[model samples]
Target chain A: MSEELAAVEETARRRGSRPIVWLAWFLLAFFFVNLAGIVFSAVVDSFGDNWFGNWLPQVWTTHYWSDAWHAYDLGQVLQVTLIVSVAVVIVSVLVGVPASYALARRNFPFKHAIMLVFLLPVMVPPIAYGIPLATAMYKFNTITHVQIANSMFGVILANLVPAIPFVVLTMTPFIEQIDPKVESAARMCGASTRKIFTRILLPLLVPGVLAASILVLVRTVGMFELTYLTAGTDSETLVVKLFDSISGAGIRAPQQSDAMAVLYMGMMLVLLVIALRFVNPTQLVTRVAEERDA
Target chain B: MTVAPPAPAPARRHRPPDPRAHLSHRLAERGIDRTLWLLLPGVVFLVALFIYPLAYGLGLSFQPLKSTDPLYNYKQFFTDHLQRDTIGTTLRISLPAALVNVIASVPIAYRMRGRMRGKRFITTMLVIPITLGTVLTADGMLKFFDPAGGWFNKTLFALHIRTPDQPVLLINNYWGVVISLIISGFPFAFLLILSYLSGIDPSLDAAASTLGASPRRRFWQITFPLLAPGLAITFCLTFVLAFSVFPSAYLVGNPTSTTRVISIAAYEARSVETNDSKASTIALIMAVIELLVISVVLFGRGRLYRGSTGGKG
Candidate 1:
């Protein structure tokens, strides 16, 4: 009876471990197919008149590489996207840092109420915010010098809603982490108010601020929703070019568009990895995941 | 407890005066001036960017496009060209996708708990969609999931010798959108759960295991109960994310009036028809509904984690 029981327990342990095996398989399946598709796209585009066909043919060339450059509006799209991203980062930090600290520190009345005010940008999706932001900008003729629609500025303005939240969220933890005792020490030394901030607090906040800025850059530059709505016909971003090309030709040259897509992906991935060095990426994803597991 | 003992005074100094001494002592005790100075930039930034935007947005909502007393953009949105259908569509797509994402995320998250083989690789793969930009993923799906030249139909035909002309799975339809949602939405939920999983007290789990409970029973009794709050948060986040589903749908979802959600409707109102007031009203309406939903869920999640060792006692 003891021997039989030992065997049964061993069998149960094996059964318990099966889910991990299955998950490994499931992830592999998803990744492999996409990998294959990319390779097939590369090889087939080289060989045949059927531009986006399933298989390779006898005749092949590097036509798509050149085509990818011009088929999509690669040159202009990247410029607009980079410009919008930089602007959003500047504005978000300008807006979010002070707001986040006030919420994190301070004991004024309506304190919680003040924090609640910032949550609107976070709760509502860009789709919802984009309409009013874009429309309001349009009313003033300030969208872009390049005919407003499809311009870089529109995307930057619309992106502010989400980017501001990113700043507030990231800055809250860092600001709240400051040791209050240090500030008290400065006071006892007879330091003037301006002297204390300029000399003390600002220096300490450098790492925190750098972390916040990189975070804002990575997401804001890559943002898509508001850009799609507000950008002019001629001012395609990297995403717009990618979307137009693979889905079939728009003004973006199709063959060259693939190269732009690959380049965009490469740039974004590099930035994300760099950002990860500054801040924890898991903080964004696992806020809820951690809750479920705990 | 940690404060320094009072400093030694100058040797020749006389005893301090009463009122001046009293007033100086109080200011020194509270350190209010020093604290405010440290907090200035953050305070100024919040007031200008966050508070201003929200107040302005609210004001914009009430303002009318035309003349005088609270004009009728709200009225215009109600009457506009098939514009009213947007809310219904956005919620229909958003709600289902969010729910699906939250549910699918659990299994992957469970597998990821405590670090097993290939875990980092799996996590990276899951987050690829997020980094790749929503547009690229949707575009990739468009290239691969189409009926004729796409991967799904092509694969099925190769394996089973089925009809090649049959519709491809997950392209322009609601499922396509859900696939995108699951791909992008799952990583954050999975990571959040994974962190929470790591934080859970192993002793409680050990106690449950010793009590003759099976693994599944232990999870339900010990893990799931504690995890309820986290689940609620994940649901709200995933819902908000899917709620704003535009680029993926617009880029990949074949632009039928059927898939065009409220964002598209609001966009058309302002851009296509040139009506800022109505668009503002519509956007405000969206903000109100989403905010209301988020508050109800967040408040109901029981409590924020209170025992964490991050703060001063």
Candidate 2:
């Protein structure tokens, strides 16, 4: 009798969870289907001759892709993107890693205040600060004749505002996870500070640095507001190019715009794939959330 | 090759020790060592690029080009109907979208919190939007959700949800921005809430179940209270992101009027009108509004939960 009752309870529990499990799956399916459809449509529309009011384009061609490439000067745009992304990655890591080591391994007066200053750029959206930054850059250009605004140099600097803080935030937790005894052991071996950092810490920090780099690379590519505010004609990245193509009143087919967008999306997807290989997406959010809780 | 030191060095000791080395020793005692110098470059960069610009902009806002009044820019923003109504328009779009994103993610995240098959696959799929960003999403959304010939309408028509004569007009209107926000913001809220949910002890839920509490009861009575603080933070962050809706409002929605968020106002003021003072004023206003909303949520969160829900985690 007891066995039958327990069996009945088991069935009841399963039945209770059945609808929720189904609902979860249904939502996931719904979201992915829409996402896939959205992305796929861009690809299909770019190649379509004149797709209108149909499930599939009646005709397709690669002409738009070529047209967009030349019309948008995408070759230069892509090169600028690569340059900006790579520069931001290297510079941010170089500047941020040592700061992260100091922040993680020591206690100092106003540490939290310093951290809040670093955190502000990441927490606040770019548009809030980008306006001021761009305005200041322009003013500086007029006064100092340095020409930072509306130039490639300006774009790199604007991108770095958030990127450096992000690197520090991500790397701090990674440094904390390493045992301090490792550093002590190096010290015991009579290794100087610089030598310990170069010989001991750098080798152990490769995975963390790689993860931070890829994440920053992906962000800098997609960064729009700051770059848009600061970039000049010659300095525009692929994303800025795509935006101009869309909002521009140029007499080009919509398919051309779609083609440019596809190229941008393709680049982003590749970078994302590489980033995911080295980092667990959840691990990134966990640290930030834990910090908030503390 | 050892050399003996000079006898006692008493005469040299009359002068103060090297001032630089003495200062360094004091600084190091306070946890500022050579390693701390590494923080200098980043701090200098931020101050130069972020803080100084913002300060300059703030000062500039007070000195509008045409008006002598220090408050003229602020006055103009509040007085002009076109500019003033944007506060309402922005909130109308951001609030519902953020609320829906946070509220919807709670249940889904709750169910998916435990170890499960294909977890990484689903998490990665959700996180893809963060990297895809507003630009790509907006571009794709314009094509995918186009009323005239988009797949969404096609699907609706095929499913008999609506007649072919009447397709859903999602794009180029208010609903378009909301949908775009949900698409991008939902994943972020999900990721944040999932982390918070996973931090809770599972034993509490098991104990509740053992006590014969129904699943629904256990969630509402136990988990919901514990999860409130996290939900507040997730909502606040998501709300902030949603409030700064610029690219989507431009690309997917009607940016001229229906989806004219404050960011658009600031953008037009700076880029179109070339009025740096006016633009700075609007940007400051946007930041103030965001801070107000955030502080209110956080204050309520403080009242809602005073202490941590104890757990091994």
Candidate 3:
């Protein structure tokens, strides 16, 4: 009996290591699959005529990169994307930070409702709202004496609609996490609400604000549907530009398209890393888990 | 999502007076100051630009498409092909995609949940793909899945399958869209859910384990119930994001075989057909379907729609 028990124990302990090995192998497969997908696309783009057929691009060259650098002319779209993303972040922060403060510290009526409205912006599909948004932009041209439909500002305003809710969603918790006693302490010491908000509360909440801002920036830069609808080809976004380049007026341009795709991925990867440093995806992921495990 | 928050009532004191109220209350008690209300500019901005545009779009559904037509744009929309498909297609894509994404993402999300080894690397990799917009990822998929210089071709030929002449897999069809949605959509949704997963009270988990429940049982009885609401919200949000597929279809799809989301139809109705009212109707129809899905998510699963805001202090 003792010998048999020892064998069971050994097998159980030994069995544990195999599953771990299997798991490691599986994860490696996922990584390989995804990485191969990306690199495969990148490597294939370096060739011509052999886009989908060649085992290896019979002719590989860095010509796509050198040639691509000059022609895509992304300066304008980059500027527009930057301006809109930054503007949305600033505007969302300015608006969301204060509201989150009020929501957090104050015992207000309709608290749930307000938050719902705050979240409502992102609740439905952006495209669903975009049709009317396109029209609204057209109408705003007459009323504001600004051509919002085809301009960057219109896109920014549109961006804010989806972006602000995210800010409120993220920052609300950060503000709530800070003890109200601290806010009260500031008040007792003669800090105005504004002073308290700016000096004490704001400092404590920078991480949350930064998270919200970075997320807004990333989403803003990647925005495609609204821009496609609101902004014409004349004021096309990089995504739209990429789309046009591949599927525009002529036959498909795979090499150029892949190069542009690489360019897009590169820019976004840089932004995401920068954004992730301040606004770790952990917090967002945590929120998901909490909601699911609610 | 079900009910709006009640109006903010006056803050009440517990033991008569909390010391700080006197310094601030008297001056501020009489109706909210306009300046104090400035916190609302963002709200108003959304209302005006986002909400207003959506409302304007919705209202147009009641009006006829043509000056001579006497019916609501909505009535005609449902009667028509493009608008009819708007709801059907939106639901078709969102429901199944949400299901597939949720299913496919679970093992990955679960593996990513705890302090497992390789968790960080897996997470970083999962997340990296999403940083690029749908357009970029969809476009890159072409080279990866394309027929000529595509990666799928290269790999298969290397493996001694059929020649590289035909190499398209789910690159630009319905399956392609589904694949694209899964790759781009799941990480965002998974990350959202992972945060909630980590937030499950450890006490509840501990107590369940102490009761002699198996891991699967504990998860279903204790963990999964708690997760349902968060999952619902995540599902709806992701469904919203995914069904509104625009850039992907525009970038990689074959005009006939590859692409045709409702948004594309709306764009076509406006740009190609020169029918703005029809476009608005299509948009409204899409909104209605999405709203219905959200409602089902909120109501069917015995879950409450609480914002992921509050506490953790």
Q: In candidate 1 chain B, what residue range of length 10 has the lowest lDDT sum?
A: B304-313
lDDT of 1 by residue, A1-294 (tens): 256654564455347657855875586476456644643453343334553445444455566656765555566766777777788788878777766666666665555665555556676777676665555456446634344444665566567766776777777777777876787799899888678778887897777777777767767766676676666766556775565566565655443555556677777878877766655556545321112221
- Top of the candidates by TM-score: 2
Ranking by lDDT: 2, 3, 1
For residues A1-294, what per-residue lDDT tens digits would candidate 2 score against the true structure? 256755664565556778877777788788889888888888899989757787888897999999998888888899999999999999999999888988998888899988987988876778999999999998889999998998999999999999999999989988988899999999999999889989999998998899888888988998999999999999999888888778773578888888988998889888878877887767544442122232
For each candidate, the DockQ is 0.32, 0.49, 0.45
Ranking by TM-score: 2, 3, 1
TM per prediction: 0.78, 0.91, 0.84
Interface RMSD to the true structure, each candidate: 4.2, 2.8, 4.0
DockQ of 2: 0.49
Candidate 2 is scored at a TM of 0.91
lDDT of 3 by residue, B158-188 (tens): 7878575656565667766776777777777
Best by DockQ: 2
- lDDT of each prediction vs. the true structure? 0.64, 0.86, 0.68
> For each candidate, how many residue pairs have backbone atoms clashing (under 3 Å)?
30, 0, 44
Worst 10 residues of 3 chain B by lDDT: B304-313
- Collision pairs in model 2: none
Between candidates 1 and 2, name the one with more favorable TM-score.
2
| Runs of candidate 3 exceeding 4 Å displacement | A1-28, A43-52, A66-71, A142-145, A249-252, A284-294, B1-36, B65-67, B70-72, B160-168, B202-207, B254-259, B303-313
